[model samples]
Target: MSTEVKDGLRISVLSSGSTGNVTYIESPHERLLIDAGLSGKRIEKLMGDIDRSLTDVNALLVTHEHTDHRKAVGILARRYEQLDVYANQGTWDAMAPRIGKVDLAQKHLFAPDTVQTFGDIDVESFSVSHDAAEPQFYAIHYEGKTFVILTDTGYVSEHVEGVIKNADAYLLECNHDVEMLRMGDYSWPLKQRILGDKGHLSNEEGADVLMDVLGNRTKRIYLGHRSLHNNMQSLCHLTVASMMENQDFGVGHDFELLDTQPEQATPLVTL
Candidate 1:
């Protein structure tokens, strides 16, 4: 409800959908961008909307090499003097050719399934089920507060569920409605890909995963990466909220159920 950004960990979803995806996070000593999917100019404007300076970003973390997630990886790295780009060896190998040329010094690598500290933030990466060179889900820790980013994955793994418990906040994917996708305008092969194990998570699947990981400390739950064609924002939110209600968890009381847009940034929330 408050527009001012307070003390703990602060975050905003700049945009989240099939078109493009980006998230901005700030710790006491560092400012990080989880993905640089949008254009550099667009990203700058979105950060300005939240009163954050994109030029002050210290690092850019790439989740996978998809166009919607890594489109601006090289652009932002080139534009910001202090920004360093980080990805795993496999992701780097798959994305290097697509993101254009980044300076050698600005390129960094971190192993998956390990916790690495950058400035004041500690980022722990885990493998997820997706069709990429190496996809990751991050749990970032700062001053006792945790912010987890879980999107672009087809399914949540047991190991991921174990590591992501008791997070202060999350930007989870509620990508589509299964019935809608099955009857949408996409071709047979495209529809199959979306429904496959390596594709995106549907609304029901996302709810199923949340039921396993929701905890008392989870205050903000953002339903992100919804399909513009196959899923409506109201439907996606209601689907998850209803499922949680059955488990005795009340939306807006136990935790806030937030919505993200493809064209604008969500409210900047501090946990």
Candidate 2:
């Protein structure tokens, strides 16, 4: 049966941070969750806050095996019986024990660079530099519009740039401010790990990535996966905004810049 088409593409970040991460995306006919890091109950509540429900979710996409990214994958799939869970084989293997008791039929494994279609939306995965066994980001395409998902990467690579460039909307990471992170209470090793190439993106790096990928076609950018202890929402927004202004890109005129909160769901963004 054909799924009904809605207005266009809609995205809602249910939660974003080192604590837990989840995003909801819908393309008229299909609805899916990208990384159910939050518990199933939390995800449901967040969706309900946005006037959506778990009952409509057709699938779940796992970005990596990290608890903050895959914590509720299995529970959400099992609760919603019809939900299929997609992940790379490496991610699946690493996360399987944690997720627990997922039906074989619900598992949909794909290698990096694989493209899968669900109704009108086409989902593609690409590798990201992260500490996880295997971590990746996604690009969602629908009706000629592209919405890219990028977070938890220590740095953006050439391939990642290619995948995200000139997109209509971007959910990108601005995880922390280097100075804040360095001076914060985290241990030296923890600090180094976060500063490493396999760690999270710094605010500066996020700005650089935005500069690389954003173009005339870019409409909106959501700064996500911020570090609660080391980063402030205002800081992430202003840092990126300042960079854009310095480059002659008007914050409100060139594109919209917004930050996703770790504890609350962002309003539905239509693209």
lDDT of each: 0.88, 0.89
* Model 1 RMSD in angstroms: 2.5
Candidate 2's residue-wise lDDT over 1-271, tens digit each? 3334359999999999989999999987899899998888998899888888888789899999999999888888788789999999899989988888999999998679879999889999999999998898899999889999999988999988988899999999999998999889999999999999999998989999999889899989999999988899898898999987898886898789988887699988789
Residues forming the 10-long window of minimal summed lDDT in candidate 1: 1-10
Q: Write the per-residue lDDT of candidate 1 for residues 20-130, one digit (tens) a residue.
A: 999998876788899888898999899989888877788999999999899999988888878998999999999989988899999999779999898888999998888
Candidate 2 scores a C-alpha RMSD against the true structure in Å of 1.9
In TM-score terms, candidate 1 sits at 0.96
Which one wins on TM-score? 2
Best-matching candidate per lDDT: 2
C-alpha RMSD by candidate, in order: 2.5, 1.9
Candidate 2: misplaced stretches above 4 Å? 1-5
- Superposed Cα deviation of residue 242, candidate 1 (Å): 1.1
